[model samples]
Target: MKIIKDDLAGTEIKALLQEHLDDMYATSPPESVHALDVDALRRPEITFWSAWLESDLVGCIALKSLEPGHGEIKSMRTANIARGKGVAKTLLQHLVEQARSSGLHKLSLETGTQAFFAPARNLYLGYGFKECAPFSDYRLDPNSVFMTKCIKE
Candidate 1:
């Protein structure tokens, strides 16, 4: 599979993002949903990427620069059919490498504390991300779990 930077304008990618948003809303309360829409992902601070297997879009992920040496993981999703195929894992590894190469000293993310997000929290934990206080514009919320990993300089 090939992962490339995306413009967030393609029909397939748009549809996939919409699906991701839907899932987020379905799983979390409106106030707790932090997943950005397409327009937000297109901002200069965010670098979006899609994983493609030939012509099919397999998954997508984004890295958002939070500061000079910090980044956040956003919009990580694998197509329904692509789940269990390591698409998310591969994309995450790719993002980590990209962040390190870009001179980022750390990477962080916010995910739900609900059962629906358990798998995601586990995935982050497996990658050495530790629970942390909210960073950036985030405020403390019982439904939210913040995680961060320090990258070797």
Candidate 2:
């Protein structure tokens, strides 16, 4: 798979992001949904990347610079056709590597607390992210689960 920095321009990626938002809303209440849409992902502080398996858009992920040496994960999604193909894992690894190389000392994310998000929680946990209290502008919300990792390398 090839992972490339993105600009939220391709129809395939836009469709993937829309599907991601749709699932977030379906799994969590409106107030609990923190997933960003295409426009939000295009913010200057967010560095987005999309993965391709040959000609197929397989997955995407982003790292939003929250402050010096800190970043928050955003828009992590694998296309339906790419599930179970290690696409999410690859995208995550790429993002983490980039963050570390770019001098980010920490990485964090907020995900749903429902059963629908079990796989994602497990993925983050396996990658050394530990559950933490809300960070940044996030406040206490039972519907949200926050995980963080120290990546100073």
Candidate 3:
């Protein structure tokens, strides 16, 4: 799979993001859902990427710069058809390498506390992220599970 910086203009990617939004809403309450839609993912603060396998979209992930030396992982999703194929893992490792190259000292993310999010939580933990208090603009919320990892330079 090839992971490249996405320009947010592909019809395939747009459809994939729509599917991602639909799934998030299906699994999360309206008030507790924090997944970003296509428009939100286009923000200048966020650097987005889409994984592709011979023109088919497999997954996507983003890094949102929060402050000097800090970044937040966002919009991570694997295509339903591509699940269990290491797409998320590859995208995550790509983001981690990008963070290191960008001089970031920490990486953080906020995911749901529901069972639907277990795979994601486990994936992050396997990468060395540990549960942490809310950071950036986030506040305590039972629906939210925050995790962070210090980048070992």
Candidate 2: list runs displaced more than 4 Å.
none
Query: Which digits, one per residue and each the tens of the lDDT, describe model 1 over residues 1-153?
Result: 999999998999999999999999999889999999999999999999999999999999999999899999999999998888999899999999999999998999999999989989999999999999999999999989999999875
Of 2 and 3, the candidate ranking higher by lDDT? 2
TM-score between candidate 1 and the true structure: 0.98
Candidate 1 regions off by >4 Å?
none
Residue pairs with colliding backbones in model 1 are none
At residue 136, what lDDT does model 2 achieve? 95
Q: What RMSD, rounded to one decimal, does every model reach? A: 0.8, 0.6, 0.9
Tens digit per residue, CA lDDT, model 2, 1-153 = 999998888999999999999999999999999999999998999999999989999999999999899999999999999889899899999999999999999999999999989999999999999999999999889999999999986
Top candidate, metric lDDT:
1
Error of 3 at 56 (Å): 1.0
lDDT of each: 0.96, 0.94, 0.93
Off by over 4 Å in 3: none
- CA lDDT for candidate 3: 0.93
| Residues 37-148 of candidate 3: C-alpha lDDT, one tens digit per residue | 8889999989999998997899999999999999999999999889999999999999999999999999999999999999999999999999999999888889899999
- By TM-score, how accurate is candidate 2? 0.98
